[model samples]
Target: MKKVKQFGETVEGYNIPVLNEREIRASAGILYLLMFWSWILVIFKDSYLLLKYANMIFLAEFIIRIFISPRYSPFLVLGRLIVSNQTPEYVGAAQKKFAWAIGLVLSATIFLLLVVLNSDSFINFFVCHTCMIFLFFESSFGICFGCKFYSMFYKEKAHYCPGEICDIKAKQAIQKTSTLQRTVVIVFFAFVIMTVILFNDGFGAKPTSLWLIVKSAFSK
Candidate 1:
């Protein structure tokens, strides 16, 4: 019973329970793609079918992760297989649990609003996007945005963050951003805005079918 109910694994050389950061990130990526696709369907097709199903899946997955062992979660199990070749990067489970608790609440709210209540509102818009942002950071940047709040809620500092972000240390040379790099990024954005302003009409023009164009050219 204890094994089935356990939250994290007790690995060798670790005093506290830990989980594979790689698998967690992989799982986040999977969820993010699912949610993003549902959002696109909602926007382009004006359909809530996919989003409804997505909310149900998201809520159920989080429930399993929090209540049962994460080892049993389907998404995490898939994630484990996807990243099986990579070396495991273990992170403290305590902070992750706190962060995922927030996820559970968000997923539950979305499920209730869209699936159960059969309603739509700005609250749904805001919460859905917020969940995506969290998933995006976790999957893309290895940043756990929700874990940032763990220290605020608890007295003890979070340990073993994804990138050792919890420990205060000097930035490595490679991690430092140069002034030139920052200026280059700003200049690139400026160039992009200028191009958009100059070519808005051309860019917005509808594209013709290549086959139709070819047939017309041959006939002419």
Candidate 2:
């Protein structure tokens, strides 16, 4: 059982030094979704406190993860609890550490620009959007953009990536799908789009401005 340690796993011949890919990705998924909504609040209400303090807390967690240990990270603890029943999907911890290092740097930058300097400017916007992209890819797609730097900066390749994306390409067997199945999937979404676009008038009345924009776009 390897003493049920929270950081890293020994798989095959590789010695990982951090959380498995699944738990980390799941944690990132939760974190990014919350951050995204917080950003939306920033957009509408001009709320910087939520975004600023959240970035600082995010950087602190990554510092614990990268320097102290993943076991001590509160976010990773929540991540583990979230995916307690899922099977482990192991990957190289060194690469993930590299990724989190980038995360720490980005978070620190956001903290400095938004929190300390009070710079409500486009540079802050650009950095925030970039972080969103990184988080979105990792959380939504299980793709680590910063981990891609592992091979370029180091000698070894990251293994057991979420989709085996690091492996060399192999020919895949083709399977034919019926046109009826495709039609069903397409029709389902088409129905949903029409329902929202055609029937929904003002989108809950309070957020009428957003709905007005959508209505105007569709009208044009």
Candidate 3:
């Protein structure tokens, strides 16, 4: 689909592809959610075939979105439908395209190394972990690390990046955390850490995950 240019937003006298920020993030959230679940299954159940297919799907989606059209990407189409009624948050699309290119590279690598080569290697693990990290940040917190990378190498930062991460520093309470909030967060984590350390079970053994635990409960 051809991007509809915004009435006035432009950088360096070039009309950028303006898009609904909410839909983009919503779509990303959906995709990441799928990837996270599939990866967890692979890690726990050793579902190599399932993981291979998932990687292939991600690779294809990225290729279509980047090379052909976003409308042709099934995940993005579903995402747009999901957020069709959402209020539009217009953002610069050039940086998003750049970010998608980065995603393309990651997905393509996973497809070639893990799915195609069928290697159960450390490098494949690293690639999958890195992909999850990137996706998790974006889906859960609306922080696009790829967009941050784009801003770092490029002169113009993403205008209206998600979560206003690229926004100029301004004096505001929201920008600064209160001492009480900081102390509460730190104390909470410290307490949890101490509780785990003090009453730990299976200190060296791989703990059974909630997924496995639930399955055992039902199967019995």
lDDT of each: 0.94, 0.79, 0.75
| Top candidate, metric TM-score | 1
Query: Superposing all C-alpha atoms, what RMSD in Å does each candidate have to the true structure?
Result: 2.8, 7.4, 7.2
Stretches of candidate 2 above 4 Å error?
1-7, 11-18, 174-220
Which pairs of residues have clashing backbones in candidate 3?
A: none
lDDT-best of 1 and 2: 1
The whole-model C-alpha lDDT of candidate 3 against the native structure comes to 0.75
TM-score of 2: 0.74
TM-score of each: 0.94, 0.74, 0.80
Best by lDDT: 1
Which tens-of-lDDT digit does each residue in 4-120 have in candidate 3?
Answer: 322223445435656566666777787777777887888799787767877888888878877776656788678778889887666667677787888889888888888777777
* Native-to-model Cα distance after best TM-score fit, residue 134 in candidate 3, in Å: 1.6
Model 1, 87-145: lDDT tens digits are 99999999999999999999999888888899999999999999999999999999998
Clashing pairs in 2: 8-18
Q: Which candidate, 1 or 3, has the higher lDDT?
A: 1
